[model samples]
Target: MRADHPLRAIRQLANESLAALQADFSALYSGMGRPLIPPERLLRAMLLQAFYSIRSERQLMERLDFDLLFRWFVGLGVDDPVWDHSTFSKNRDRLIEGDEAARFLSALLPQPRVKRLLSSEHFSVDGTLIEAWASMKSFKPEDGTGPGDPPTPGGRNADADFRSEKRSNETHASTTDPDARLYRKGPGMEAKLAFLSHALMENHSALLIDACGTRVSGHAERVAALAMIEAHADRSRSITLGADRGYDAADFVNERRSMNVRPHIAHNLTRAKGRSAIDGRTTRHAGYAASQRIRKRIEESFGWIKTVAGLERPMVRGVDHVGWGFTFAATAYNLVRLPKLMARVT
Candidate 1:
């Protein structure tokens, strides 16, 4: 690969970040077991999956076997044998179980080189639904009893008629992934089993400062936003939080104010009988308009995550697994954008 190729920057960033996380990786594995795939290589492979939109571990391994660029990026020699896809997956689950994904993301921004690009006092938060791997057909009643029989019985793809039969998260659950909840993005949108993924982006550089995935709920967006903001907020110095109208709630605004964070949420004139929680006092500021404008850039991160990173419909099942993928994707998004940002800074 050329010196100016994007992966060169990404690989440098990954190397620096992984070097800082060596101890954590060591702690995750036992010294006695037959040597497993190095956690660093596994993480590099995961990053490649996000970078190239490789859909599955099997396909990823196939590329790693023959693609010299991938081999170089992953620190594998040309003649080294690739691990079986199943073995790669099993080791990946171990990393997820050890919370290495979140740790890796946390290790990135604190680097002196990257820290300068962050905005300490201005940020944006948003959430999108991550469709669960489970199918709606698996959403059966919790009681184990449902409408008589499938249209095509004794087969895995049997048709289920949900017409006129009331179904809800309260009385039903997905057998495939019990943690998933049925959710609709809008009034007329089709509902699907999904988890809500939230990202907190610093306005100055439009880099994701924090991210998480949570069970879908009516208030999950606001709740997750508050949690992430609290984690990053400085109580002595007030910060500004930009969000869409979905975050315009009285309680959420009050909570932000209590934390010395200004809620620069867009006015939801249609909500609460046209009474927006955000009043003229908050919107009158010049900074509020600026935040509103900068906040949209966060969508670029989300677009890359879903479309480029191939997480629009996550392959993972449970909330923990989904959260791992979401956070790792955030890190990958940062890596992809950082090269240009650093070049411009230099």
Candidate 2:
């Protein structure tokens, strides 16, 4: 509450972000349970812990009990009781993914009289690897033991074809985690089993319209990119899909075009030259080049999700739970973005 205190800024940011989420979530979450804790307060506290790297549920609880701003964000007045961290983790499971976060984001899409930062038409697409909650060590593949068996103990590094070896973290490994898999940009390298998170960002305002995380591909960048076409399909039927070199595959390009979407994916020099190229004839599209240039900025949104927002590794096991965590993180990120989005508005 002290104006001079450093945490005041944190509290204000946390409060505003939570307030936005509260409005979107209130009606839908009503029957999920009594507002066990004010969703805004609890969510803001979670965001603070993540952004500040507080780490672990216990640490978040301790801070809430002692820190004033945290207390305020979690809706605890001086005399009110603070909810336990477990209460949060418990109710959080009820939060939805796939559609829930998207719906909340849709609600906050725009305010009256506010012009959008990025025009719906001027958007870019990209994806990033989110290391799962499992470790390569614990994920050793099962030796042909069964159809969906775990990797054998010592054989964790067996296949150069698997994506687990390259993407798994060696520097700061997690103890409670056993499901993490390694992944890399290239194939035949199983570094970490990862979730591919694709995001579609409106360039000028950097608002994210859609995001989908998957566990199947090492190349989620291209996979989640189908989103651009799907979302834009009903709007105009014909749209430009911009992306990086990873999306320079024949099938991916063909797939986008078939949907009536123009593929503005960057040309991969290595593949663009030889006999492997998409025929020099078909490679000539100006819009494609322009789209490639703007694709880098798209990475910003995902960067914020992984680093600034602390979603690099999922919070829970199974793709579904991890997906749930990402939805909340994305919702939180948009809340942080709302002020910037509305800043220039009259």
Candidate 3:
């Protein structure tokens, strides 16, 4: 593999970190049974899925069986038999249960060159809706149905009519994905069963430092953002957090200040209260202006993850699995960004 090759960079990144990753993987499993697929190989394969936008695990395995670049990156021998797709999924569940994706991101960040590019003090936070795999038909009444109730003629995939029904998270839930919720970004947009994927990104490189998925709700975005921010919040140093008008609530701004952090959140003049949570006092700084300008870069993460990484409508069913996919995608995004960033700096 030549140094200029794209997968070469990722291959190097994974290989260099293999020792640490192995230590982490050991804790997730006890070495007592038959030898299984190496966790590192599984992670590399998962990253390949993100890089190529493969929609399903079966498709990923199919590609790995024939694609030499993928096989090389995944450290698979040419004649190695690909694991069954079902077995691959089962192994992946173990990684998700152990939160390996988050740990992968953590391990990647301490690289000497990458550390210099990160801005710990200035960051932005935002959330986007992840369309759930479940369809509207799956969102049925939560109450027990009478035995006399007729089943839809076509079974689980049967067409459902919700046109006249006033469906809400309170009264109904998705039978296919219980963790997903009916949600809409705004009034005019149609709601879908979805989860909110939130990220805390450094303004310097626009790389995600932390991310998580949560049940969809009006306040879930704000709540998730605070949790992400608080995890990195340090009392010894003040950090500035930039956000859009959606984060302009008085409580959120006040909460940011209470943590000894500055809130550079864009003000919402359209609020019914006729006032903004952020005032000229905080916005007057040049740093605040820069934060507002740079914060929009965070959207690039969402755009790439949704379109390029095949997360537009996640195939997974639960919030935990969906979150695992999102976090891993974020790691993949950073990996893609790092090589280009290093080239420019050199």
The candidate that achieves the highest lDDT relative to the unseen native structure: 1
Q: What is the C-alpha RMSD of each candidate to the true structure, in Å?
A: 1.3, 6.7, 1.8
User: Candidate 3: which stretches are off by over 4 Å?
Assistant: 145-156
* lDDT digits (tens) for residues 240-292 of candidate 2: 76667677788887887677766666667775344332445445866556666
Better of 1 and 2 by TM-score: 1
Q: TM-score: which candidate is best?
A: 1
What are the per-residue Cα lDDT tens digits for candidate 3 across 219-253?
A: 88899989989977898889999999999988888
Better of 1 and 3 by lDDT: 1
Q: TM-scores, in order shown? A: 0.97, 0.73, 0.95
**Candidate 1: regions farther than 4 A off:** 148-156
Better structure of 2 and 3 per TM-score? 3
Residue 53, candidate 1: C-alpha displacement in angstroms: 0.8
Instruction: Please report, in order, the local distance difference test score of every candidate based on alpha carbons.
Output: 0.91, 0.61, 0.88
How close to the true structure is residue 14 of candidate 2, measured as C-alpha lDDT? 47
Which regions of candidate 2 fall more than 4 Å away from where they truly are? 1-35, 97-99, 113-115, 143-182, 187-190, 218-220, 234-237, 272-289
